[model samples]
Target: MILKINDLSVRLGGSHILQGVAFDVAETGVTALLGRNGVGKTTTLRAVLGEVPATGEVLFDGRPALGRATHRLVRDGLGYVPEDRCVFAGLTVAENLRLAVRVPSPDFDLVFDLFPELRQRAGQRAGTLSGGQQQMVAIARVLLNPNRLLLVDEPTKGLAPAVVTAVAAVLERVATRVPILLVEQNLAVVRRLATDAVVLEAGRTAWRGRAADLLSDADATRSLLGVGTTAGRH
Candidate 1:
């Protein structure tokens, strides 16, 4: 395993945001951290990155990872694509990417290959780009680091359907090299990218199974995901 969370719980403002959340990501696959709004998806990612105080075990390849700072995680081959892509408005696209690069890496070229629009407008200021393009820049920034594990939170939020499709394609390409722990609300995107599903209900692991299995079962979808029944199966 590349990353493991064992009985992890996060407390923020005296309330438990994540309760006994446990999952593992391998070196070569995608794991979708699926949950509804305010169900602690972002908090879970923060705990893995050590952004907040958390209990229980966070192990990277059987070694203790708790209390490690976010930058340390980055140096240890973990990349984070935050839910809100905090691209610098005054900086050019190239400059924003340069700021996020941790070390000298050929991985920057791979990012441009995945999102050609970034390559095309490398000189343009990031603040002027469209939402989808900005999202690409955010992801490309992390991709430049050559990290083994990526903690992606809500990449497709507030995007148009076509833009979501395009971003999903980029994520598919990224997953070929990096193990992605994707926290997303869109089932369509999850179904496309994830091999396994770890569903959260009020910050707890309500269900864990193959993405195909969860997508197939209407009852599980209704109970855990609050979605209407559908006939789709991965």
Candidate 2:
């Protein structure tokens, strides 16, 4: 396992957001974190990166990872592409990616190869880019560095069908290199990219199994995710 969580819990504003959420992320491929809205899917990813206070056993590469600062975790080879493609609005495309370079020699080749448009629009202001373009910058920034695992939240949210397909293609290529802990609502994208699946219900882990098995069972999909297998299909 590249990442492991045991008995993970988080409380925010005096409410329990995650209650003993636990799962393992394999060293390769995408692990889909599936759940309905408000089930702490994003919170779980935030907790793992130490963006929110959490109590539990979190092991990253077999080392204790809990309580570490977010930047330290990033420096330790954990990459994150947050929800909503949080790009710097004032910065240009190249500048946004430049800010993410941590190593002496950043992997520009890989990032440019994955997102050729990012290179083409290097001088364009990120705020002026379309939603999908901004998302590309968000993902491209993270790919500039080497990472053991990537915590990607809602990569396809609010994107057009064509844009979603494009993003998924980039993610599929990226996953071949680094393991990804993905929080996605789009079942079609999940079916395409995820090898393993973990479902969260009411802030706790409800199911963990092969992605194919979970998606293939309509009853299980409806029960846990509050949607049918066809939900969010492009």
Candidate 3:
């Protein structure tokens, strides 16, 4: 396992948002974090990165990862792509990607290869770009770093159908280079990219198995996610 969370629990603002959330991420391929909205899927990722106060054991690369600072975790080879696609609005595309270069990597060519438009729009302000372009920058930024695993939260959120397709293509190429712990609601992307899955329900591990099994079972999908087929796009 590349990542492990044991008996992880978190309370924020007097609410127990996550309780005993536990799962394992393999060393390669995407592991989808599936759950309905507000079920603490996002919070679970936050806890692993130590962005929130939590009680539990988190192991990264077989080392105790809890209580570590976020930057240290990244330096240790963890990458994060927030759901909101937090690109530097005022910065140009090249500048935004440049900021993420914590260490020199060959990924500059790799990222641009996956997202050629990023190279084309290298001079454009990020805020002025479309949602899809910003997401590309967000994912590409992390790839530029010396990262072993990527924690991606909803790369398809709010994107148009065409944009989702494009992002999925980029992510497919990216997974060939590093493992991905993906938090995505789009079932189509999950089915195509995820080899394993950890389903979250009410902030707990409701189900865990191969992505193929979970996705093929309709009842389980409806019961846990309250929506069938994360499949989208026209």
Candidate 4:
């Protein structure tokens, strides 16, 4: 396993956000973390990266990483892409990618190939790009560096169908090389890309199994996600 969490718990401002959440991510596959809003999906990711105060055992490559700083986590081969697509406003696309590299890696060519628009717009300011383009910048930023695990929080939220397809393809390619702990709500993308899934309800893991199993079990989906809709709908 590339990542492991056991009995993870978190509280914020007198509210319990995570309650003994635990899950494992393998070295080379995408593990989708699925849940409705305000269910601590984001908090779980933050706690894993030490962005939120929590009590837990986080093991990366079988080593304890509970209290490590955020930069240390990145330096140790962890990459994160928040839902907001936080790219530097004044920086050019190339500059943003250059700044995200924690270690020397000769993967710039691969990054450009994955998102050709970034290469064509290398000199454009990151803040001016469209939402999909900015998302590409964020994902490409992590690709420029060496990574064993990626924590992606909702890559397709608010994106057009075409853009979602594009980003999904990039994520597909990324999963080929590094393990991904993805928190995505798009059931279609989850069904198409995720090998396994861990569903969180009220900050605790409620289900764990193959992605296909969850997709096929409509009762399980409606009970866990509060939606009876099928994949690729709404």
lDDT of 3 by residue, 125-208 (tens): 999999999999999888888777899999999999899889998898888888999999888888889999999888799999
lDDT of 4 by residue, 1-234 (tens): 899899999999999889999989877789999988899999998998889999978898778888889888888888999999899979999899888877655489889889888889999999899999999999999888888899999999999999999999999999998989999989889988999999999989999889888888889899898876565454
State the C-alpha lDDT per candidate: 0.86, 0.94, 0.89, 0.90
Question: Which pairs of residues have clashing backbones in candidate 2?
Answer: none
Model 2 residue 153 CA deviation (Å) reads: 0.3
TM-score each candidate: 0.95, 0.98, 0.96, 0.97
Residue 113 alpha-carbon offset, candidate 2, angstroms: 0.6
* lDDT: worst 10-residue window of model 4: 225-234
Give me the displacement of residue 12 in model 4, in angstroms.
Answer: 0.6
Q: Provide the global lDDT of candidate 2 against the true structure.
A: 0.94
Worst lDDT run of 10 residues, candidate 1, spans 225-234
Provide the lowest-lDDT 10-residue window in model 3.
225-234
Pull out the clashing pairs in model 1. Answer: none
Model 2 lDDT tens row, 56-76: 999999988998898999998
Model 4, which residues run further than 4 Å from truth? none
- Candidate 1 lDDT over 6-59, as tens digits, reads 899998998989889888877787899987788988998888888989999988
